[model samples]
Target: MEKTAFYTVKQIPPEETYPVRHPVLRTGLPLATCEFDGDDAPTTFHIGVYIEGKLAGVVTILENAHSRFDEERQFQLRGMAVLEEFQKQGLGQVLVREAEKEVERRGGYFMWMNARKVAVRFYEKLGYIIDGDEFIIETVGPHYVMCKKWK
Candidate 1:
């Protein structure tokens, strides 16, 4: 791995996220798991972090509301993943920050996610708080509802 890795975050089309998401997030699961609802909506945006011109990470921001949050201006962070080789390089952080900025740009003040248990600490480090009881997502195992709000 190079110490000075070059990476850029850019908004990408929803379909372009399948490759990274399927390998990083959905592994044994069906490829369909990577296709999320609202993914192709006009208000929804997908972001990919490209390193050395290869897609290394991806995150989708949907202008959708979570029932738990009563706020009207809210967005959901879905299918956030980084390639195994790309993990721990702070690319995940960059993806989330870029997604949050998009939410903020659209007048959204709240962002929430069904964060995998293993990634809770990662999201926590980025200022997201666990919002409710932990639960299982069947094939996906345990997850927690985490949220970050900004004015």
Candidate 2:
């Protein structure tokens, strides 16, 4: 299959993102474990990248506040994951850029996430900076709170 033939990224329903989010971000856990807080909020949005009509990557953005940010508009990015077969193909970056655009359009001043330690470099390459000390999320592993500000 031509890599470009069937690739696209767009906003998707929160439920539609579960398949990719579960396997990648919460492997071996119950499907319910993949559900995130604020996923159904009016201010929350989900983005997905599809290849060959299947969900290949997913991300969730919540219009929430972080005490660390004094900005009036803050978004918490959560459940960002891409299938192993699709990594390094730029799908993750595409999803993140699209999400950032949405955030900017909605007047968001900052975006933050508890990013996995393994993915810190990836976020850094996208202009996100480590905001705090490394921490753990129970069954999950090491993570760092990373943030990016638009203004």
TM-score against native, each model: 0.94, 0.94
Candidate 1: worst-modelled 10 consecutive residues by lDDT: 1-10
Give the distance in Å from residue 23's predicted Cα in candidate 2 to where it truly belongs.
0.8
Q: lDDT tens string, model 1, 11-91?
A: 999889999999988889888888998998999999999988898999999888888888988899999989899888999
- lDDT for every model? 0.89, 0.88
Which ten-residue region of model 2 has the weakest summed lDDT? 1-10
Error of 1 at 124 (Å): 0.5
Candidate 1, TM-score vs. the true structure? 0.94
Give candidate 1 regions above 4 Å deviation.
1-5
